[model samples]
Target: MKKVAPPQCLQNAFEENGLTQIDVFEFPEGTHTAVDAAKAIGCNVSDIGKSLVFVTETLNPILIVMNGADQVDMNKAANLLGLPIRKAEATEVRETTGYVIGGVPPFGHAKPVETLIDKKLLEKDTVWLAAGTPKTVFSLSTRDLRDVTGIETGVDVSA
Candidate 1:
């Protein structure tokens, strides 16, 4: 069997952060949603930490990690961050994060940007997140996750 090449940025982040990388699974196109990703990984949807990329009116990029079953409350997020928030279009997401909409990881951006993590995601010991590609995901402990990624916890980004 042929092996798939891992996303370079994910590998780079693992190296930079001294993290023990988990396994990644690749699916065919159009499996970017949490439900579809869970199906591909043979896990529950809530186990997937949906990485949402948003842009402020200033054009600054930010990442939000939420439970797959939850939706981000933009108004609440804006109030928390004290900035006007807007859903980043596909073009802007790629331009700022160097990753497409469904594949934006919680960490390892081209540079550091503010990050907000939903409190609900803490329920699990480990959560799966995108690895710079729609078809790829990796599992990391929720506690140790911040060691490799700069995530601000206790934010209610979920609705």
Candidate 2:
């Protein structure tokens, strides 16, 4: 079997932002959630950064990079952004981020979405994220993630 390489757009974004080496991994089928991803990658669940997209009341897309082991506090997120929160539909996610639920990267979206990085991720040396597919993931440092993704580091959203 052959491995599918990551998209050039994401690679370019990483390079343009001076990111370190990006490690891509291929797992078995149905490994979409973070727990499954952690098992596949042999890492702690908290090391898996889940890239979530939410639709604000203004119909704008907001990107939230959170710890896999943590829960997103929608109320806090809504309060911080001063916008009503609605679960972003799958179609909205694809339309805005150009990636599906399990494979949304912090960067390389169709447009620049307002990004928020979980403060907890800062404590980790590296984190794993989906590489445009449910069966694939990539590893990079927390600082590199923020730099490459242009994500603002914050603690607005809590578990």
Candidate 2 — worst ten consecutive residues by lDDT sum?
Answer: 1-10
* Clashing pairs for predicted structure model 1, backbone only: none
TM-score of 1: 0.90
lDDT of 2 by residue, 25-125 (tens): 67766447889889887889999998899999989999888888998899999988898988799999989988888888878787779888888876788
The candidate maximizing TM-score is 2
Candidate 2 — which residues are off by over 4 angstroms? 1-3
What would the TM-scores of all predictions be? Answer: 0.90, 0.91
Q: What is the lDDT of residue 119 in candidate 1?
A: 87
Candidate 1 has its poorest 10 consecutive residues by lDDT at 1-10
lDDT of 1: 0.79
